[model samples]
Structures are given as structure tokens and as C-alpha cells.
Target: MSNNIKNIVYRTLSKAWATLLEINYDYRFKDGTWKRISRESYDRGHGTGILLYNVDKGTIILTKQFRMPIYHTNKDEAMSIEVCAGAIDDNDLPESTIIREVEEEVGYLVKDVKKVMETYMSPGALTEKMYLYVAPYSEEMKVNEGGGLASEHEEIEVMEIPFSKALEMMVSGEILDAKTVILLQYAQINDLIKNRE
Candidate 1:
């Protein structure tokens, strides 16, 4: 390794991510002493999404929403079943994002969203990462639709699929989305949503 040829990791002085057809295009800027190099790197963005699992009833709350990106390729296959998740809004905490999104999308307040795993949502062209979690809840917890803003173009529909049925969906290709499949199987394998009180 040459001394001058520093393999220094480019630090983002500032950046902005625009949602392009349900994907994030993050533009970041790195500052050097001599000049600024706008390095284009994939972040695999760190965001939070939760799988609401009910142990006593063995059920998991989910959402049925339309995804534009998939619809573009599939044409007719736009709507999807997914766990509640959203990007970590600029400088916003993952916890905050989950709490807010839960209320807005599926109407749940996930208190202890146990960290499940972190992985890239897509690795080929775009740089995006996801922090998957399990949000445990019961009758005592608050769950209600927060009604998305019409001005922002959000039309989210909520669904409560049984744990077994959710698993079936994963196997039968009904719940084909990556995050939804991952969370469902992960819960089943870990016994996170077993029928227990």
C-alpha cells in the first residue's frame, strides 16, 4: 500500500436520498482538503421495520399495500403483503420511525422492537440496507390505523394474518416480498410467534 495512496473511507459531508420507484438513490458528498469528490457508493440504507407478533394467539399483524417498483416490472402484480417498515427519516431514530410508521401504516405501537437482523434490501445496483425487527404486542398495546396523508400519496391497507397462515403464504409464494418472507420465516424458526401467553 502506498503512503500517499490512502485507502481512506470517504466521509459523507452531506447527503440526500430520493425515493425512486420504491428504491432509494442516496447522493452523498465527501470533502477532501484539495477538492470535493462526490463519491457514488451504495449505503445499503439502515432503516427499521417491524413484524408484530402475538404469542398468545399465534398471529402476526401485517399490511397489504401497493408497491410501485414491483408493479413496474410485473405490470399487474403491484399490491403486496409486508411487515411495517420505513426509512429512518433524516436524522430520525429507527425507534421513532417504527413507532410512527406502525401507527400510520398498520396502527400499532411497537415498544420493544427486538432487533432481528440487518441486511441489504438490494445489492446489485442500489445501496440500501434494512434493520428487521420483531415488535411484540397484545391486547394491552395500542393498535390502530393512523391514516396516511392523502397529499403525500399514501394508501396503505392493514391486515392481520395468522402466524400459520403467514407461514403458508411464505411457502405458497403469496408473501413473496423479501422482507415479509424473511420476517415470517425468522419468527417461525425462532418461535417468536408461537401460540403462548
Candidate 2:
């Protein structure tokens, strides 16, 4: 607790699919005055997302799936094109979670993935720190059809698109997922693919 903030309190609002809590706190102003405030925080735990690329093929693996939250905002276009990702779940490390997710979500059993960065997808209300990564992939690395798991009701469409096209999609507003966009930009800025023309 910082000196600027004090008298913290938490109350559970919901404990379904994810946990939601209402937090009340008192803040001290620079002028020596204190004020109380209330805010709702949604704790869904942390997750990971990875950008699987193939320099030899000049392409990248992405996933297209229906997002209910997106549907809530824009019903006309609820399908989102994004990097393969999932909740960290019981995995002890973010790296392990992403590795397993890559195989289960995209059918690629990638062994080496370089962590690029981590970000809070939505810090204002959601407590989800997304571990972003980039990994090299090839046909030999694929083990299955990688459309996500049926148990989770995930109907993910695997897309192996040219790197340039992925960039174009980012510009065309087709790839609106923040983690996907950030990873794509990271690849571009870092020249992760050399054969991309």
C-alpha cells in the first residue's frame, strides 16, 4: 500500500466464469485531503498468445474464431482473426502455457518460442497479463489439424497467410485483437521474417 492510497477493501460481486470484485479505497490528495472511491475489477487470471511464423514460407499462422465480447460490440462482425492463444490455466510458467496452446490451438508442436513481451490486455478492469511470443514453424512441426479443442467449444479456423497479407489485414481492420496486433507489429519492427517481400 502506498501513502497516496489507504483503507482498501474488497467485495466479491460474482464468481461465475470469472471472478468479479468491487474494491473500495481511500486516496490522499497532495493538499492533505482524503477521498474514497469504488471500482470494479474482473479477475480472469493471466493468459498467453504467440505469433507463429515461417520465414521459409514467408507466412504466419493465425486463428479466426467467434468472440462473444466482440459480438456484444459489433454483431455484424463477431469473428476475430488473432494469434493462437489461451488462458495460462494450471501451467506454472507462461512459456509452458503458450507451448501447449500452440499445439492444441494451431496443431503445431513448436519447441522454441522467444518471448517478445507481456502486456495487460485491459488494465482498467480486467486482470489479464498476456505473454506475447514469436516462434518459427514449418510443415514438419504440425501434428494435427489445430482448430482448438471440442471440449472447450472452440471452433477456431487455422489460417496460414503470407506475412505481407497479415500486415495488410492489420491495416484493413480485419485483425482487431490487441495481442495479435501487438505481436504482428513486433514481428514487423524486429524483422522476424527475412523472406517477407
- Please report the candidate that would top TM-score against the real structure: 2
Single out the weakest 10-residue window by summed lDDT for candidate 1. Answer: 19-28
Per-residue lDDT over 1-197 for candidate 2, one digit per residue giving the tens place of the 0 to 100 score: 39899889999999999999999999998899999999999998999999999998899999999999889989867999999998988546999999999999999999999999989988999998998989999999989999999999999999999999999999999889999999999999999876466
Where is model 2 poorest over a 10-residue stretch in terms of lDDT? 188-197
Model 1 has a clash total of 6
Model 1, span 129-187: residue lDDT tens: 78888887776676665455567687878776678888877888778889888888888
Q: Model 1 misses residue 48 by how many Å?
A: 1.9
State the displacement of the C-alpha of residue 114, model 1, in Å, after optimal TM-score superposition: 0.6
lDDT of 1: 0.72
Candidate 1 regions with alpha-carbon error over 4 angstroms = 1-45, 195-197
List clash counts for every candidate, in order: 6, 0
TM accuracy, model 2: 0.96
Task: Give the distance in Å from residue 192's predicted Cα in candidate 1 to where it truly belongs.
Answer: 1.2
